[model samples]
Target: MGMEQQAVEIVETNKPVILQGGCLCGAVRYQLSAKPFDADYCHCKQCQKSSGAVFQVWMDFKREQVTWLKGEVSEFESSDNVRRGFCKQCGCTLSYRDTRYPDYFTLTIGSLDEPSLIKPNYHIYTSNQVKWLSITDDCERYQQERTS
Candidate 1:
């Protein structure tokens, strides 16, 4: 699924806003109680391989904001800093976590029940994007991470 070009700022307050979603097979159900942040399209090679797509759209929410309401997920240590979570039954990418940000968990936007609520603000790792792929969006494109 393609994300909107507009950047969305999510601020989490004491009050929780429930965002419900799950896997394709309904084997994994979850709820996020806080606003999400850093929603972006990542063109990194690892993300392309993990999602089997040209790019992956991800959004970060506080670790405490997420509640797994149903089945457990299988995890793969994709890199020294990245651990990816997928539904065991459906083999759908569910979540992503980087060791550098232990307090946050990034979820695949395609798995969300309300994906339209969030929009990608930028493109990360644009240097690694597939040669055949052309990005036409007006969003900011970073050579690597946003910080870099």
Candidate 2:
């Protein structure tokens, strides 16, 4: 239910491994390649408003592993070719896709049963960071978007 710090077993080698995820209602299910890359947290207003929480965690993985398990997902065109996929029943975000990055899909890290395996590597939208919530000096903080 909260951010995990414990590591999950690495079920595979460098080769593609099955990674599982689904919505809160379990209506929409998906699988992605294991060994996610560039796991991070977003603090942008749109993300805060969309999640209605402190922040959103995301893990980048190859898109080929993602698929609809049970039913269809409602999509919102969040950005250029980037569609936000969520379950119609639970209204839980499943993943985000962009044809530009068709090879990589950014999956919600919070959706993972083992979020501990993935930790926030960077913080985005530090310029809009809440005054009451201070950013730790340990990790990189970008005032705006950091492509790198």
Candidate 3:
């Protein structure tokens, strides 16, 4: 079957699907036991700086759902309670975690083996988005992080 057909089958089956991904240098690899949720594009300054892009696409998963299949990521305390993970060997950004929400974990959409499987449902921190960037998507926009 084609890629689209395979994706549809995975969703229709309603079974736990493991998504695999890794860093640029292949030094770090991981797997998600469950499908990710709350996929969104973040335009926050932190995300822009960390990703070196106009915005960063991130998806949320439960901490328990993540497994380090290969090497572990080195974390940097980006903010008071927020830490970002990267592959030390290649310096590829991999994940994010906020100590305040220990149960939640986030992964960069670009790092996924099949990045097209996840789609951004909304945009966050739009207020900080670059002035030159124009987002025309119909997805919901939040001036900052979503409270609900």
Candidate 4:
């Protein structure tokens, strides 16, 4: 099953009026008011290349809720539907958005104001996951395309 069918979305909070996050060199920072709509791990080829790692963990929230608090970012248009934001100084990824999904943007889990609050509900593209690294938890795993 795909994420749309298997993943259960957790309702976000409205009362938490603030969340803080920053880049590696602290050159860029961001703030958000709404809780994440989805937190998941992606193991796609693009994610591997973008992060220089096996996978990427992300926390998605409303685009309107995110605010740049410290510095500006240089963006790259990844696709017709998505544009990525990163700090030019430290090359730290802050946020990303899909033109088709204009209402929300996904942030790297590491960029969370408090990293502890982010909880991944699923892992996508497990077919390409490194055998040496493992996830011991019970989150749902997709072998290939999430829609498969």
Candidate 4: stretches off by over 4 Å: 1-18, 145-148
Task: Score every model by TM-score.
Answer: 0.85, 0.77, 0.87, 0.81
> Which clashing pairs does model 2 show?
4-116
Model 4 per-residue lDDT tens digits across residues 44-139: 877787777888888777778788888887788876877877888888876667788777788887876567666788898888898898799899
* Cα-based lDDT for every prediction: 0.84, 0.69, 0.84, 0.75
TM-score of 4: 0.81
Count of backbone collisions in candidate 4: 1
Summed over model 2, clashes come to: 1
Residue lDDT tens for model 3, 1-148: 0111111112333554468999999999999888775678999999999999989998888799999999999999999999999999999999999898898899998999878777777788999999999888778798998766
Clashes of each: 0, 1, 0, 1
The residue-by-residue lDDT of candidate 1 on 24-71, one tens digit each, is 999999998866756899999999999999999998877898999999
Q: Give per-residue CA lDDT, model 2, range 78-116, as digits (tens).
A: 867778878889899867677776677777877765555
Q: What value of lDDT does candidate 1 attain over all alpha carbons?
A: 0.84
Candidate 2: RMSD over Cα atoms?
6.6
lDDT of 1 at 6: 48
lDDT of 3 at 91: 98
Name the runs in model 1 displaced over 4 angstroms: 1-18
Which of the two candidates, 1 or 4, achieves a greater TM-score against the reference? 1
Candidate 4's displacement at residue 24, Å, is 1.0
